[model samples]
Target: MSEFADRIRPHAPTRDDASARRWIYVPYDRLTDATGPLTEQPASQTGIVMMEALAKAHRRPYHKKKLALILASQRHFALKQARRGIKIIYEFTPGIFADGLEQATRHHRLSALTMMQPAEREMSLDVEEARVRGIPLQLVEDTTWCSTESDFDSVFAPTTKHFLMDRFYRRMRQKTGILMQPNGEPIGGKYSYDAENRRPYRGQPPVPERPRFHPDSITQEALHLVAREFPSHFGTLDGFDLPVTQAQADEAWSFALEHLLPHFGPFEDAMAHNEPDLFHSRLSALINISRLLPRRLIDDVARAAHSERIPLASAEGFIRQILGWREFMRHLHRRTDGYRQLPGQRNNSSSDDPYAGAEPSALNAHRPLPAAFWGRRSGLHCLDTVIDQVWREGWSHHITRLMVLSNLSTLLGVSPRALTDWFWIAYIDAYDWVVEPNVLGMSTFADNGLTATKPYVSGAAYIHRMSDYCGHCRYNPRKATGDASCPFTSLYWSFLDRNADNLSSNPRMSMPYVTLRKKPASELNELRKRAAQAIEELCHAQQASPQE
Candidate 1:
């Protein structure tokens, strides 16, 4: 037996006389699958294992709310299982996940181990480790996801090129018969209502307040453990009210369908001060943890739309997020091998810097991420507001994440890996499989256009038009070089100019290239100088005050 197996000590078993032959390892993310192997075998013949691997928690200094949610939800699920007359072994250890699993198997004297295939590669690696140590581990299909790996492969295998999300989304709609007419066409004569979903909130109908759940004693205990262990982590525990049970999750879902779904379409992209979740369903954390399943949620939304309880646009928009983007991202992550290519691979020889010849300097991708990312004020209204909300709530809607945080980071040329790490550590819904494809592929265009047809970079003009962030900002969105010039505006021109060689030939970027060429050499030089100065100042501020 391994050294880790020596730490085998069962804290709680459902029954002392139960003869357990198989152990089911229940990861925190798959907390709701009670019908799997747990139900296949007799309760007395089965054992469920839940672990609090402290080393894994400390990997990247996750947000306090994220930590609380995962731990609390896992503990609650374990207790729920215990009440169901199922044998369970809960392990709290400072060692790794594999060690915890090995300990559980040995402590219970189990003959076989079975687990639902984990969504994350890291968790999968732990299972592989156990198998190598002579433990018989059976990997079952993870029923949490709406689509399986085979489903993704079946659609993309016939095509040689990179898979586009829109095409895949249409396939999913057809496959699932969601939002479809009786004749097998999309409802409302179109597959997407994205154009209808961009209307800004002018404070007309008023945004409804979302329901909040108070933490019970079990959740409070989980909060205390996280606070004691990760005192210095990002985010706060003050407003930690995420749902930890299936009933609580169902109530939250019902609340969204009733009050928020009506306006969810039009104002989905809009952002305002003090509005962290404008008409958006704050269900990602719950869905991620299996408190709410994706297929059930999609079916509920579709039924509501069909019955005229919600608008077709609203239902389609919500469905697209889950069925289209979320599913597409997972498939893309698996397809691209998590986008593990070098930064320069996408740049062509014609687009390379004249000074650097045929190769772009690796230094372009090595810039350190600034402290403003961790809630420090950058004196930029939009950035400060978004970061502050993340520090307090561990979440922000997709638009702010894409347009404000990600767009600015791309303009500043922050290392893609650094930004990816920050997002994974900061968000309550973040998992490696999701964050990597989003931050590197769509948000930053760091994979150069693998997922996005064009980079999502924009000047302050787009920001000012889409949001109320510019109303109170000190910088002028119109200016690109003055003292009060918006950093986004300056960097916008500079980003286009600096990468002109690489981007000029792309047909989608032709208009931006034409505008870049229209600018005088002096103006272009000035924009570059101003952009460099702004980045330097931001970096200096971060160094001076490491914490906000």
Candidate 2:
């Protein structure tokens, strides 16, 4: 027997017992029939273990809506399974997940506790520890993903130094035959429609109203539970409309197809003052929780485009997010172990200058995350508006996340670790698997060129063009200095100036470097001073935060 096999002793069979009692442990996120031991094991013989692990939920200051959605989903799934005559051992334990699992396993005297492989690395390690501690824990394959590990390996191997997302996306397209012609060409004669998808929304095509799901009894109970337990947690559950069951998720998906799909591609990158869900599918929370599978959604989108019900750009754009970015991020996070070991190893230049060849995490960005992130008021209209939306809904589209939250954080030199944790805690769709690769690699360039070729840092001009935030703001987007200068504008120039030596070598950054080289020393010094003041003001706001 292997060392792992030997450590996890199987439950001894009794003379009177024909077979050992086996249980399938279901986590909060894995609430579907798509993957895990639930698929392989016979329902008649297998018992189910569902836990409401309060200790685990309280580890971070998670948003209340996120907490309610997860707990409510788990409870509803358990009830559905029980109604089908499956034996469910539901444990509402106040301990951590591992503690609850071990206690339940021992109390039941099960032969083995089978589970789907956890999405987060910490939970995976916890499972390994349980096995080593003599618990008969077995992990089955996680089949919720549309692409397999083999598909990822075909594009980029373990030893491959450079990896492109487009190449990986193409491999998945060929493997799945999605949006591909009979002759194996892309349907639109192009692999990506990202270039054509950047048009800003200008109030022409009226944004449709999304359907709201009234809270069912189970969901109401879950919300009450969250309210009583985590009252101090960030975000309110007053307007929580997230789907808690497969049926509700299906309804939401259908609504997205009818209303959001046609205009999703064109205005995907745009941000408006009060429109938080402008043409966004808003299916990420449901999809991430496995209430809806990625494969089915992609198939539906391809069919819609083929029938000309929705434009090819809209279908392809949405499909790429699932087949291209979502799958890519999952595999990358799995390979890198949440990017804990990726930093400082990629750029190890022996230089006195800190950012001479530093990776994203090593860019010496030691500033703290500001109080505005937690719904505290900031003087800037863009930050305040986006943060308020996120606080209310537990969501924002990708562009708002990348350009507004992560962009400004990067320019202000906030710690990557802080930003990563905040993303995981604040957003309903964010998990360790998705949030780390995005915040560390793509958003912050912490992985240096692992996921993104160039740092996504931008001046206020990009925001001004992409959003209507500047028009309503008190500060001037064009100014890089003085009291009324836009913080994004000032910090952007300061960020470029601070890291000129490190980024100037890259061909993609040549344009910005050329502009930086032309700027006189006096103007550069003044910009740096303005950036320092902005950082100081943010720190003051953080110290004065209500939550603090």
Candidate 3:
């Protein structure tokens, strides 16, 4: 055992009389005091139960950096609590989360436990099961989000098939008053600055370096632990630079305000060949893991914009992500019963695999997710670069995620469940609350417009216009049939042609369908042949991959 683990493992307080103490269970993500159960009870009267489930960590090929970040952050949080005189029952145990909870409860004599509602569906179910077994658990509201379930229910009916982000965002703006005027209208007379935020970067103003936090002794221990435990997981363990404490997270936020936010809007959608994090705030992992609270970050960003420290587009763009999309994902996850209520769940499937027997996507996509996603080079510069970035960092900007990864997956007819599983396994910021709604509902249109108005699929032309990867790619963006043709271009037309019946009626997709119809049948035949060749190559690559 490591010296740190040896020193810290036996710190659980011993008490002859344990029934008087009430305990709080802290999940891996919910590590902040802003919404933590500690606010509901005192440290003297309340103990803390912290668990690290080895089996759960190994359930999927999670990013190695993600595992290290979570482990380090949880350890830091527990250490902070221990210093505050809180009795901590920290378990680095085997099996699932519930198993660890059971061991802690049994050994520590915890009769009644209090905890915040977890951000993921499986943990929530585990908590429910514990309650069903008469554990006397007091479940508190998850206060991490700016809006509550009631807020979502107020604007959207229970039977509402589609959840509009703009409407929900407006409600949150009015509720939080982040970018609102005194008259209750949105500041600058607009709720969205999305149109103004889509400029391609020509490298006029050079991108600044993001602040990196070198691992401390505690973080080093966590890194070693993850390396020892999850050696086979995806992503590199080297270059672990994320913030593990609130102070460090605040420092990163301050750095973003000064250096990154100025160009974050204009370059928000822009992707460069080697620049993986161009002007985008690397705060999603910190925010999702609760090192930084959303409300404070949103308020600070608004204040910065209002004071002319940053442009309105940048502030509104950043705020829209946190105040708009982030909260929408959470609420929609809960509303949709956190993937349990998603169509096509099998009766025999385990809770660990929510989408195991999921039906074919709306477009009837059934091909396996290609091995290219697991770090194999597809010979396409855009796909290869983004995959390599994810392999190294466990992250990529949203544009790369939506337009490149998900777009290609959609066009290539990769199975929605397979793609969703890849996303959940690969991303550092992914959780059921965030990853499921984004993958199934928005990115791939697997939920068939339940959370999105239209599919986010795009052709090579869009990729070429938005990124420099096309310039370096061997494939031609203009061609759609020959061996030199871009897969995105060829498959995009094939996708539209293949799913015209299902998508042609969508108001947003009418023009695309018209364009698809304008193409000659001879050229459409060639495009399908090219798409078939690409899928065949992907099948060969996946078959050769050991991980697949």
Candidate 4:
């Protein structure tokens, strides 16, 4: 019934078949059990050190509650696999986990080992290492996500056309034939009801709810271990109701259906200052784990929509998160194969600049950006300020994350690496596949032309259009050119001017830059002065923060 049974069905090595059975073991953070190779491979705990070092670099303990969440999850998976009659050995390494995989094989007498594709850097490292050693290796489909690699590659390989999400989405519909009629046609004369999904709550609609679950003994034990081991972590564990088992995860998913899915489509991108869970189905963590599969999740959502148990938009949106975005990320990450080296991936690209030279490179790679890249806890410092706040909450709406944090990161040149890693470490929902592409490629432009046709760089006006943040903040989102001017206004112009050779030559940016140049001389001078002054204040602020 499980993917493991299928992979090793006829080839399973038993005592009758061989005198000794050894394997390469990987403990997944999401799945309940540990997995091993039917072949020979060595294993270690280096992933623990990398996890610990990441926290230490950020001045948070390796045992911090957030870090603890991952460690606890992985540890539990290892134990589960062991109970199910699999071999697992743990080791510690500071660099990539794949290096440990390689080392384990070298040290062992076994022929070769099997492993899962790691969540971050070192996927290729493991595969290549296996090849170099002339050892047989098995690459398994990560059952955590529903789509297989072949599914995405096949869909993408057909035409020489540029990838469009909508096209792939349509094909997925035809293949699964979800919400379609028996005649192989779509329901309601349309495949998408996106237009009906976008209503800003005027407080008139009934307030939808998120499923609430009490942690059972297993999750409770994990919570206690996290608190005890990482006393200095950033988040509070008082409200620890995270789903840890498949049954519990199913309950959590069902709860999303009953309480949240109806409204998810409309407010999916909306954000409120203190509202962390606005019409969101927060099952990414479990989805990343093996307890749930995206295909099944998508199928369930389609059923809900066809049955009219939920609105089409809400169901469609949910499916996109699981089926579209999550699946695309896996393929993108695997295809890129340049995860760690990408600019600003593990650290801010800004940190590599001379001004940020003395900053700890490793720290910058993994930790949040220095607060100074923003304002004095005031204006230009929006992304850092917003992210620091989010670290405590472990959640925020998509708009808040993108428009406020990701947009600000791009405008501030926070560097793709640092921003991407921050998104990866801070969000409970983050996995390498999703976080890297969104943060590195979409948010920060670290991956160049990988995901987006262009970087999503924007200023305060976009923020104001989407949310109420501008009204509550001190900076003037409107005033374009002076000390009182919103930092985004001047900084935005400055970015365009500075990168004109790189940006304006483009076909898409010509109009916006032309518009900026149309400003009067006096206004342009004011914009320059305001932007420069803001940078100075920011530099001073960075100098004042405590270093790790």
Give all TM-scores, in the order shown: 0.91, 0.92, 0.95, 0.74
The sequence of per-residue lDDT tens digits that candidate 3 reaches over residues 1-548 is 76556656666768642566678888998898666678766777767888888987887879989999999899888888877777788887788777787777787777777888788887877777676666767888888878888999999987787788999999999988888998999999999999998877777688887778999998998898888887778888888998998789889999998889978898899999867788998889989988888998898899999999999999999999999999999998887775446544333224465534334377788788887887677899999999888888899999999999999889988888778888888889998889888887789998778778889988899998988898898999988889999988888988898888899999999999999889998999998999989988874564422243
lDDT of 4: 0.57
Residue 29 lDDT, candidate 3, scale 0-100: 88
Q: Report the number of clashing residue pairs per model.
A: 1, 1, 0, 25
Pick by lDDT: which candidate is best? 3
Model 2, span 436-482: residue lDDT tens? 88888889976767788888989889999998899999999988799
Q: Kindly report which residue stretches of model 1 are placed more than 4 angstroms away from their true locations once superposed.
A: 1-11, 14-22, 39-46, 158-161, 341-364, 544-548
**How many pairs of residues in model 3 come into backbone collision?**
0
lDDT over C-alpha atoms for residue 107 of model 1: 70
RMSD (CA, Å), candidate 2 to true, equals: 6.4
- Kindly report which residue pairs in candidate 2 clash with one another: 360-446
lDDT of 1 at 322: 95
Clashing residue pairs for model 1: 351-501
Candidate 2 residue runs with Cα over 4 Å from true position: 1-22, 34-36, 343-360, 540-548
lDDT of 1 by residue, 191-298 (tens): 999999997777756778777889987788879888888888878899888888877888999999999998899888888885668899989988887889899999
Q: Global lDDT of each model?
A: 0.79, 0.80, 0.83, 0.57
